[model samples]
Target: MTGIKDVARAVDMSTATVSRALRGLPGVSDETRVRVMETARRLGYVPSPGAAALASGKTRTVAVVVPFVTRWFFAAVVEGAEEVLRDRGYDLLLYNLGGDEAARHRVFETSLLTKRVDAVLVLSLKPSPDELIRLDHLGRPVTVVGADVPGWATVRIDDEQAARHATDHLLDLGHRRIAYVGGAVEGVLDFTAPAARLAGYRAAIEAVGIAPDAALEADGSFTVAGGVRAGHRLLSAPERPTAIFAGSDEMAFGVLRAARELGLRVPEDLSVIGIDDHEMSVIFDLTTIAQPVREQGRIAAQQVLAALTAQYWVPEQVVLPTRLVVRRTTAPPSDG
Candidate 1:
């Protein structure tokens, strides 16, 4: 059978307007409504239960947009959210922003504008301020995971402060000259982890009254391979740093591998610290900033569900605290 979307297409009206027209609801012009109903009846268009529920006020579903599903952080968030959403009888419609900037833009500007979902839960998307405002006006609640969106309720970690704390851990161990290994995936602008971490690293150096070394900045790709390439470049410098602060545990693992290849001793020759306590962080003894990724996911889903269920939930930015996890990867500078 034909659908409201088909009828909407036939009459060149929105599915929402078509739905209102079919259900005899107010807000649509009588002429347009007549055209939509006529098109639907003549074309044998049948609205699905989900659309009907929407017209009647219910769906038990939320739309989740994420930058990447393969990434450990994003995957962890989804796993956590899935568990919560599934338990509460809420359906999740996951939209993957497949590692492409253009694809992400299309997903945000077009795909998410659908009327199928009840609420929205966005993962680490930093849309332009204008786009975010437009989303706010879409008449449904929104929740952000892994970062803050000014007007919506956000469940995330204190990324900047966590990075700063990680830097302090390295500094406390007597390492003064340090290089940064930042995991900045190419293409997505929604997440500002790299910028925030860089700020924290700079802030920490300034707090200790050490001049920031612009030469020590190296971009890693949030993978072991990316870290290895970055590590080689940073290590090959004329003035190699005695310590490295990697933006992620995965990148830090790469640095460790590179150090081993170059016959450098861990903590004795160079110290390394990273953010995100990946499962392997402990196995590799990587000192890191540990944030509860899964917990953030669960909380974000709860916020979305609350919005759908008409429960009282204040839209506020909730930053979960992070702690510095001390491991064997850090030590006093040997020359000191």
Candidate 2:
């Protein structure tokens, strides 16, 4: 089998220099790095992951923590992170909590203690104080997605601003009785997006000199079925809202279904808007605030890599932009 020594001999470089170049370590000149790579390729020499780990004390693996792997947003983020990790010659370790408290506990308490990963990338989870302390004990680089954490790298959208944008669009269409469907559960430990979005919804209405009504706020649980339930409850009221702002496109899809079941015409009798331009949004004709879901994952992975490579790296707090995507579901209220 071809080896590093053979490549180093072919390139007339020291084994240490070749090793440094191959591992992408600093202090190697660009010209020598390129030559070592070309010679290694010519000799078909492949570095063993175990040997690399032994040399650098790095596992060459990153762990990605998600609430549920089946969800669209989580799945898309994992796909994007995997792409970057694969290209950078790293392996991914996935921790799927599945919304189970025991599973979440086992992951943060025991599983992460195994030292199997060099870094961690968390998705949408606001860990408890104990959990955060446990993660801090790991002494490894950690990057969070969809939530902000102190002293850690984060990649997320401005949830409050995005929600405000969605509500403002409805208000501009003369929707005074706008109903908000969100995913928050009271007295439950969860992520921060739902609360931030709910605040934004209230802020938009209050800005226009309107008092926010608790009756119009429905918990959609960030799912299509939940949206359907919320939709029915809101539509059945004596004074139904002409417009609804769902926290996610999945919920918006449910609202559309509910509207259809109730024999109402979209944009004629009712209009709806949502956040996250989900893959199925086009089919649903959902007007939404489009966020770069997959891009957030890619950026989080890049952050992990940057921390791994840099000797003195500062944790980054990256907030991406969201834009309103006008589609067939939103329009001026029929009365207007």
Best-performing candidate as measured by TM-score: 2
Q: How far is candidate 1 from the true structure (C-alpha RMSD, Å)?
A: 9.4
Cα miss at 250, model 1 (Å)? 1.0
Q: For residues 71-137, what per-residue lDDT tens digits would candidate 1 score against the true structure?
A: 8888899899989988865678888877677766775666455576778888887767766866776
* lDDT (Cα atoms) of all candidates against the true structure: 0.82, 0.90
Clashing pairs in 2: none
Q: Residue 171 of candidate 2: its Cα lDDT?
A: 95
- Decoy 1 TM-score against native: 0.81
Over the full model, what C-alpha lDDT does candidate 1 score relative to the true structure?
A: 0.82
Winner by lDDT: 2
